[model samples]
Every structure is written in C-alpha cells, then in structure tokens.
Target chain A: MNRMSSENNLDKPKEDEIVRIDFAFRKELAEKVEGNLASFCYQCGACVGDCPATFYSDDFNPREIMLKVLYGLEKELIGEDSVLWLCTNCYNCTERCPQDVKPVEVIISLKNMLADRGIVPKTVSRIIDTFEKTGRTVQLSSAVTKERAKLGLKPLEEIPMDEIHKLLAPAEEDSGK
Target chain B: MNKFAFFPGCMIPARYPHMEYAIRKTLPNLGIELEDLPEASCCPDPIYFKSKDKLSWLSIAARNLCLAEDKGLDIVTNCSGCTATLSEARHLLEDEELRTKVNKRLARIDREYKGEVRVRHIVTVVRDVAGYEAVKESVKCKLEGLKVAIHYGCHLLKPSKIMNVDDPNDPKVMEALITALGATPVRHRNWFLCCGKACQDEDIPANMMRDILSTVRDVEADILCLICPTCFSQFDHGQVRVGKRFGEDFNTPPVYYFQLLALAQGIQYENLGFNRQRIKPKILDKIETTLSHA
Candidate 1:
C-alpha cells in the first residue's frame, strides 16, 4: 500500500492540453503585417491590465490573442465569429505592452487575414460598401446639406468618385494574405 | 493668420454640423484660416478600413494628404479619428518601401505621397501653434466657476509613436486647454477609460459608457467636455441609450470643446445649437445669462 503512494507516482501530460505551435501561420502573419512584433511577447499581461475590451468582455483579451499569435493558432483568431472584432481599436495595448509588441496592430493584422478570406461582420461590411460607393462613410444627404446651410457653412462638396474609385482598387489580382 | 487645409472628416460635417459652426466661429478669432480640402473622402475611416486592408487605408489617407500638399498647407482635422488615420499614414509612409508601395497605388489617380505636409489635430493647433495665452486672450466672457470634465478620446493620444499628440499616460493638454478657457478642469476617476464607441459589440460599448458617465456624475461636473465628435456622440446620444439600459438617469450634458470655446468667446447661446443636443445643458444656460449681464 505504501509502495503505490511513493513509487507509482509519476508526472504525466494530458493529450488535449498540449498545444502545438503553428509556425507556418506565425511566419505568414509576420511576413504579411507586423514583421516579428508578436514574437517578443513574454505574456507579462500588461496589455490586459489597460484593455477596456478585456475589462468588459469575458472573452476578449489582448494577452491571450498575443499568445495565440505566438503559438500560431490561426484557426482561433481568423473567422467571422472570432473575438478579434471586439478590439475597439483603442490602442491602449500598444501603449502598455512592455515588449513593444503593439498588440492592437497584430490584432488588426489578424482581422485583415479574416478580411482576406471575405469574413467580416455585417456592420463593417456595410461601412466598407458605403465608403466604396460615396467616398465618405456617412453619406451627404439633403438633411446634411440643410444643416450646413442653417449654420451658414458652405455646402459639402462632392467627392471625385472617379479618382476615389481608382484609389479603392484592390492591390493585385491574386494577393494572398 | 496661419493657413490650414481643414479636414472635417465624415462625422462633423455630416452629423454634427454645429460643432463645425463653433470651430468656424472660434478659429478666426484665434488667427486660424481654414482652407477646405475639396474632393476629400473619409480618412477612409481609421479602424475598419485599415483592418481590412492596410495598403488601401494608406493609399486613401495619402490621397487626402496630397490635397493639402497641393495648396502648400498643412492639414488640421477636427475629428480625432481623422487625425489618427492621417498621422499613422504619414508615420508609416516614412518607410521608403511602404511609401513606394502606397505611391504605386496613388499613381493610378495621378497623386503621390511626397510626405511634404504634416497632420495636426485642432487641439495641437490651439495649444502649440496659437499658444494657450492666445486662447485666454480670445475669451471675452470667461467661463469662471464652470467645471468641465475633459475626455481625451483614444485616437487623439494613443500609440504615442504614431500620434505624438501628448503624454498618453498623463495627458495634461486637455486639462491645460480647459484651464486656459477660464473653466475648472475636473480630473474624474475614470478619465482614461475610452468612450468605447469603436467597439463593434453593442454590450461592450454600453458597459464602457456606463462606467464613464457614472464617474462624470460622481465628480458633479457641470459639463463633459471633449474634442472628438465620435466621443461627443457617445456621451450625448449614447448617454441616453445607456440610461435606458442601466435604468439610471445619467443626464450629463456633453459639449464639444470648440462649442465651449465658442461660448466663452461670446458667441450667442441661441446660435450655438445647444437646443439640438440630447441632454440639455442647463448649466450653460446659467453661464449664458451671466455672460449676457457681464
């Protein structure tokens, strides 16, 4: 009985607990956007301390996102329902990270990866479509024109859509994320 | 008067034209001439556009910058989001490779990012270019005894390497600007928390607004003063939404910084569009009456 307590005890690893680092995804993110910034994170969680998203949402954490980036877990980050959309783009993490990791930049780049796959929230997609069509995200309607006139301000000028269209053109035929 | 290519961005000119009115009314008194950058689009939007495609974001921002360079003038933006986008674009384009890539896109429209002109937020223009003393000199009826809680929204001061507008951790520019206007600047407990307007999820922004408004209430400030239109919308219109959800009366009146400046400069209360705001600024009415007698 005593032998089972002392001699039979051994440290063992769980199968599901082990996370494999996806170097290919990590290398892709590094090359496409941030350029080796996520690799510096030591997971001090300084970014998590100031992040409002983390404070409010149970799921959104910049430190965890950075850890996933470090582990190259692309499946968890780039998706339509991924928690990356909750970022708020406040840049608090960019200011607080001791590693100069710029976690917000990495998060944005990940969102870019999602966008590359045409996975975006409806609200974001609508804003992009509006901007693509009229140059401004908020359209200039008769009401806006009337409001400007009421203030004695000049009417809003029309954007040169011809030029804006040229600028909004996609960079290449097959630019992969 | 120093000339600037006034970039109104999307929000102010479209949604809050009165903020634009206050800006136009006050800037001339401080010796700033606003030259409109015609045919300028959105700073394409600081967040979603950039997140979707960084290259497209840089190209659109550079295109706006070119409009200013054409007139041989620097840009002065009223919206913080616009300032961030343009500032980040200017900062990133300094890399020759990135500049060439962005410029390659710009060439399709017959424009180039020469990196000639700089982008300046209106707050910086007021504090640094015009000087705080000049701001004081322009105040005809001082806002004495009026307590203003300043909200320095995220885009104005964060990612310090790109923004460089102020010390992000301990920003004193907004407080100093408030002091120069003869108003008491109340540093509330939650001064650093963002208004959370840009967060996509509805609940997150709702919760963040509750935290912000509660602190402003605790301090008993007469008005919540901020420079960004996006933050102004959150506190003004979004304040109403938060009150209904939280089942509490958070009727803190928010005034855009320039509107407060316009009031102190003796612009008539009736003309400043206070009546249109969601939360009526009853405290401003008291100050307006006092100024009328003074």
Candidate 2:
C-alpha cells in the first residue's frame, strides 16, 4: 500500500487523491505541530467543499497540500514557494475534517520547518525583519497619526524597538526543527 | 463592566488609528474600559510569522499576553489577526510542556507567559462586555435601512474550539451588532470568507476580491462591515489594486466594525478616520445625511 501510494504520488494523482505517503515526515509534523492530521486524512475532500480560496483560484487547494504532506513531499510542501503559501489559515478545512485533520496547524508546522531550514519567502522574511526591528510588522502611518490628532486623539507613541528585539532575539538564532 | 488591556496590534495602530479613536471614544461611553498594553508588539503577523518561526512567533505573542496578564486584565484586540495570535498563542501555551519551552525562550527577554489572560476580539467585547442591549440603547443615530454585508473574517470565528468567538459556519455576532445599529445585515454568498490576506503578500488575484466585492454589489449593500484591520486594508485600501489587478471597478469601502459602532454611538465621522480611506463607504454619507436630518 505504501509503495503504491508512492507510485501514485510520482504520477501526481489529480485533485484530492493519496499521491504518496511519507511516514517519517508525517510523524515529524505530528511531533512538532499542534495536530498532524496529514497521515490520517482519508482524502475526504470535504475541506475543499467550503475552502474560500479554492472558490477563487483553482491553484489554492487545501486537500492537495494534505496529500503532499501524506506523500512525504517535503519539497513540495515547504522546500519551494509552493501552494502552501496560498493558505488563508481560515480553519475551514480544520473545522470540517471528519478525521480530525486540522490541516491549518499542519500547514503552519510545515512553514516552521521550512523557515528553520532558512527557506523563508522574501515577503514572510521581510515581515519578520520589520517586526523585529520596529516591534510592529506594519508601521503606523503618519497620515493616520495626523488624522488621530485631527480627531482630538493622542497620536500613537512609537513602539519600543529594543525590547521587541531583545524578546525575539533568542528564537532568531534557533534554526531548530 | 469588565476591563481589558487593549491589544491594537500593528495594522490598526499604524494603518488605521481612526479605529483606535473610535474604540477609545466609544468603549468608554459603554462602560467598557480599555488600557493600553504597554511594550506590546505586533500580534507578530499571525499567519506570516508562523511561517517564519513558530517558536519566536508564539513567544512574542505570549510576551504580549504577559503584559496584559501583569495588568490583571483580559485582553481585547481590535484586529482579528491580533486576537487570533494572542488568543491562539495563549491557548497553545496552556499546554504545560509548550508553556515551559516557550517560557524557557522567553527567559532571555525577562518575560514569561503565565497564561493568565483571556483574549477577546473587539466584537466579542462589545457583545459580551458592553451587553448587546446596552449597544441598542446607546445608539443615538439609528442607521436604518443601510444594508451591511459583513465579513466576519476567518480568524474571528474559526477553529471553533479555540476561537470560540461565535458559531463558526453561521455567525450572528457581527450580524447582531449590525442589526442593533438599525442596519440590515444582508446575507450574501461567501460573506464570511477569508479576505485572502494570507495569499496577498504575493499577487493578490483580482478575481479573489472580485468575487467578494461583486457579491456585495449584487446585494446592493452600502459597505463591507468587518473588524479585522488586515481584511479592512485588503478590502478598502486594496480596493484599487484588486480592481487594477483584476481589471474590475470596485468602489466599495471597508469600515472597521468599531468605527461603525462609534458612529452609531454618535462619534463624529471625522473622528473615526473615514478620511484615511481610499474608497470611502457610502454608509458614511448616508449616516451623515441621517444626522443632518435629525
């Protein structure tokens, strides 16, 4: 069954079929993340039923990512800028999964694994850098600050950068999986 | 009735201070007190930060929680992402093992998340803390006949067991608030869908937002009513980009739910920050007209 699944994955099973099974990868995810329903997913396809992203773009499929994780397609899951980034983390999949497959957490775990390997997307990394440097991922706009003053509200004081940097510095060095 | 440490997160404070003005101005009137969470950082970009470093993400979020815990108040976040990160991080750290690990890392910063704070979204605060009836009674300007298409935004009502904000699939919290303000909460297709904030750091497909805005238009709704600032930006600020990207002309402006509440509570529109928007919602004008008539 394992070898057949691997072959199916190699053939790139269309849609929500079991393309492969990566037992080790599934276990690693289970151990690290909140819940790994990756291996346990029966490919019920119920997740795609309400997935808001799939309704917009065919490329954004939650179940397909689940199949990739089950097939041990680590590279497909995280090694590249794959469809995992398209996850809205809306929890639609996790909510309706009959097998208790909380796919959102698995996707987040895969991201953590990828980030630890330093395969961070430029956008994700830049946001991480911004949060580290200024304590706020997006800076408060001067226009909004000026508007606050116009509204008789005090303008926001700048976030203390040193404290945020100090708090986040420990994990910055840890590339641990 | 209950005090909450205000967790504004990054987006609302930076991109939409008018939300703060409304929240600050309106909550006090309703007898809900909010204090600033000093030394607070971002909810650290809940989705993006997790993709970068889960440990750091949880720790940073936990540290924010600790600040509120020190204040002896549960947190009330105005942004959905902030509420998600802080609430979810607090939820995850409830695990003794995970708490220890995150705290061991937090030891470097001389902070520890004791998991003492209860995280509440701004809507939840309004409904539960302020009492929905108090909201109804406090409405000085009844925005009657305004059709509000609400986007609960994913984080506000997802992962039901964790978020526990409302019924996940069929949410009435935001709808109830809208109705209380004398507006009709029009049920539209995919009204509760994700705003695609997770995917937008790349090419935000115009079709994605196109589907949403088109539905709002189909309903002939006046504006998109929501609480999440990220979703607010994607719908309001990203309106033009989503229009240009998808080549659709979308003029619907996104208003923070609290700002709307402030308006109903009688805060001036100028005080709520509608001026900062790219595409302003028609409800603003309608409310102004209502006020001028009264």
Candidate 3:
C-alpha cells in the first residue's frame, strides 16, 4: 500500500509543482507527436468539414482542440470539460486536415497528459479493474455463456480459471501496492 | 535465419493460445526464430492509453524494449496494442529531452533505452520479412475458396504514420497473405470500421456487439481475419452476446490471421485453440475438404 500512497502523492500537484508555460513545452510535445505539422495550420476548416463525430455531436470538436493548443490555452485545453474523450482515434481528422494539424494526435497527447495526472474517468477505471482482475478486459458472465449455448454455439472453455487467477494475482497486488 | 525477440502479450499465453501455437509452428518454417522474453510484463494496454501517464507508460514499455535490445535482436510483437505502444515509445525516446525525462523516472528500475532496436508487429514481419512467395512455398494445405474478411484492428494502422506498413484505409498486405494461402479475400464497407473495442467501456457491450455483428453480417463472408488479439476476442466472443441482445441469430466467422496461415500449413484445429472459441463454424470442415482435394 505504500507504493499506491506514493503514486497518489506524486499525482497531486504541490504548490510549486506548476509547470511554467513556455513555447518550449509546446514545441517539445508537438515534436514528440507524429504527423502534427501544427505550424502549417492556417485555420482552414477542412478538418472540421471531415470530422463525422463532430458533426453528429458537439462533444467532439477537433478544430477547437487544435486551436486551443496552438493558442497556448493549456488550462482550458486540458480542462475536465474538454471533449477529447469523444475522439474515436480514427485518424479521419488527420487525413482530412488540409494543413496537417493532426488533431487526432494532439487530442491523444492531451489524453496522455491528463492520464499522467490521474484524472481518468470512472468508466475507464472499471475496465482497467476488470483487466487487472481477469487477464481479459471483457469477461463473459455465466448468463452470457448459457445464451451462447442456446444459439447452438459451444461454450468457451475457461482458460484454467484458477491458473489465470494466479497469473493475474501479481498485477492486482501491484496495483494495491 | 531471422531471430526475433518475442513479445507475447498477456492474451496470447492465457486466452488465445491458438495464436501462440500458430506462431511457434510457422515462424520456424519461415526461417524466423522467436527467442522467448520471459520477464516481459503485460503490454499494460487499455489502461496505459486510458490512464495517459506518458512517463510511466513510456518507461514501462521502454523497459520491455530495453530487455529486447539487451538480447541484441529486433523486438517482434503479435499483439497490436503492444506494437502501437512500443512503437510510440520508441519514437518518443528519439528525442533526447523526452528520453532523459522518461529514463529518469525509470531509473528506479535501472532501465534505459538507446533506441537501437526495432519494434515489428507479426503481420509486418510476415509481409515484410517472410514475403508472399515464402508464405506460398510453406503452404502444405491451401485454403482454396475460403472467403475471409480481413479486419486490420484500429491500433495496428491508426496514427498511420508511426505504423506505416500500409495505407490504413486500403490495406492489402493481410489480403495478400490470405491470397497466398489460396483463400478468397472478401471486400466489405465496415472493413475500415473500428471493432468499437476502444470504446467498449462507453457503450454497452450489447450495443458494441450489435455493431460488430452488423458489420460481420454486412460482409457476408465465411470468416473474419483479424491481426489483433483484442479485436479477435471482441469479434469472436462479443458476437454471441450481441446476437442474444438483438434477439437475432448471428454466427459470424472469426479467425486470427496467423490461425488461417497455420491451417494453410496443415496445423490441426485442437492444437490451434479452435476448441476454446465460442463459435466454431462449419468452415473448418470446408478447409479440410479443400486441403484433401489439393
């Protein structure tokens, strides 16, 4: 449990832990990402035009996320209300971006940054919990197994459940640690 | 002989042993050697990406890569998530500042990567290293007339530049390998669609299953060829639940890309973990029939 406590402490920003915003952080982060030619973006809305997710839902706007990053709106860009989660990571926006701004990569970078800060949504946490419990993220409940048999499908042989439990025992212990 | 540092992500050893059996049996015939990396940890998928801890994720992945580099062989992965994460980390480590930051955190583990090794997905190795002609020559049994729908899972091709094996939208290498196995590659619209595995948490599994079932039905193919373990598990296992949810009978064919290759090489179904799958299509009999006729 000491390790978990330490991890929790590390995630919490101290009074002086604020990263001084400079052009260098943005430049370095941008350079580390692939296919993001942010300098080429001239605010042409070609990316907005091709984003299917954006048109269907205001929750996912690649154009706005890109604009925020380019304008150095670090707080607003990485804020909790940002719609970065809605991205399907489909690369559709990257393909259609006329200026090669690569909103897809930028959004991924933002997500990665947030994850570092330990702000992952509860839904994602459950999945990781299941993955940690069972080696597989998607576990078929017993009812689902019966339904499978009703359809004339064979029941999936459990992969040595006890053995798998042992294999995954370490991850659970480590997570707790 | 091409010797590769093997990275079998968690799923292959525990759930999908068929993929492991196929790779173990086939790679040797192709003159590719897979050296076991025993201490290799979980690719820490779904969590690493969802957690978005760049330092921890990169550091952990770099530790795995550094293990391979220590062996002085190129790192090869059968899992798409492992390939994507490792490749992304490899690219990030190329920057001196990023490497220093990542390595400093990883200093606890006493691991640092010098960016000397290459991370290759099994599909990339088969297409690039083995070549179509070599695959054709190794086929003891050809899968003639077996219709297959190739599903290049999202992680393999997305952020297309890092994994620039082929065009993400119009990938053909998997199809070419299927063709070399003497099978017919079926084209479908949802070929480019995400298995929705990435968003399985957001949507109900039943909804995601329905989406997957609809995609399989739309293709109307005999079997769906998958290059990823996550997609394989989703399509093969998820289809059953999806059918029950929709109150419709949908028995879509699902097989790994290497499983098809192993079958083409005459590996038996039981050994390839076929019996462990939820859905066992009549297509296995068809494959036997086709092989006997040849």
lDDT, candidate 1, A1-177, per-residue tens = 243456566445467757899988887677554546888999999999889999999999999998999898888998769999898888999998888998988887887788879999998888888888888888777876887897799988888989887877876621432
DockQ of 2: 0.54
Give the winner by TM-score: 2 or 3. 2
Report every candidate's CA lDDT.
Answer: 0.88, 0.79, 0.69
Q: What residue pairs are clashing in model 3?
A: A4-A177, A115-B51
lDDT of 3 by residue, A123-175 (tens): 77676666455544456566555544443434444332343233222232222
TM-score of chain A of each: 0.83, 0.71, 0.59
The candidates' DockQ values read 0.64, 0.54, 0.11
Candidate 1: fnat, from 0 to 1?
0.79
Q: How large is the interface RMSD of each prediction?
A: 1.8, 2.5, 8.1
Q: If scored against the real structure, what TM-score would every candidate get?
A: 0.94, 0.89, 0.75
The positional error of residue A3 in candidate 3, measured at the CA in angstroms, is: 57
Model 1 interface RMSD, one decimal: 1.8
Model 2: CA > 4 A from native? A1-31, A35-37, A158-160, A170-177, B200-205, B245-247
- Alpha-carbon shift of residue B273 in model 1 (angstroms): 1.7
What candidate 3 gets wrong by more than 4 Å, as runs, is: A1-58, A67-82, A98-100, A112-118, A126-177, B46-50, B200-216, B289-294
- Give the lowest summed-lDDT range of ten residues in model 3 chain B: B46-55
- Name the better of 1 and 2 by lDDT: 1
**Candidate maximizing DockQ:** 1
